[model samples]
Target: MKYIKEFEKKMNLGSDNQLANGHVEQASIPKENEGSVQTYVQLLKPERFYMFLEILIYCIVGHFIGYLIAPILKNYFYNNLEWY
Candidate 1:
């Protein structure tokens, strides 16, 4: 119990009472227009485009790999493996 208390004190877990007593600082709220959807859309416009391009490339590459490997595996299994 003493070790747990010491660990909590080391980790600042016992500061909840201090926080409740107004030692905690609050985050400033953004203005109504600052946090609008239009602002977020503007911020994320390029990122969204890049994300879509990345997903499309990944899907194309995955399909290419699957198609390239499927026939090779099928040929190898049919030619080399014997099922009794």
Candidate 2:
């Protein structure tokens, strides 16, 4: 029990130290102006374009699947219809 408490105390201290260091580093960084076009361009990485292409391909595939399945679903539902 004592050993577990000590271990937890050490872990807590380590996390606090890390948090303090992060705050210091964050304070040291210069604030970027929000209106900078250069910063905006830099933020638009090539990975974003690749992600967009991936999403677009998935959307097109989904549309094609839905189109192919629609007729089958419609026929099944129509055939299974019961008189009210």
Question: lDDT tens string, model 2, 46-70?
Answer: 7779999999999999999999999
Model 1 clashing residue pairs (backbone): none
Give the whole-model CA lDDT for all candidates, comma-separated.
0.70, 0.66
List candidate 2 segments past 4 Å from native. 1-44
Tell me the tens digit of each residue's lDDT in model 1 across 4-79. 7776677675543334223434333347768677756544547669999999999999999999999999999999
In candidate 2, list every pair of residues with a backbone clash.
none
Lowest summed lDDT over 10 consecutive residues: which window, candidate 2?
21-30
After best superposition, candidate 1 residue 61: deviation in angstroms?
Answer: 1.5
Model 2 TM-score, all chains together: 0.47
| Candidate with maximal TM-score | 2
lDDT of 2: 0.66
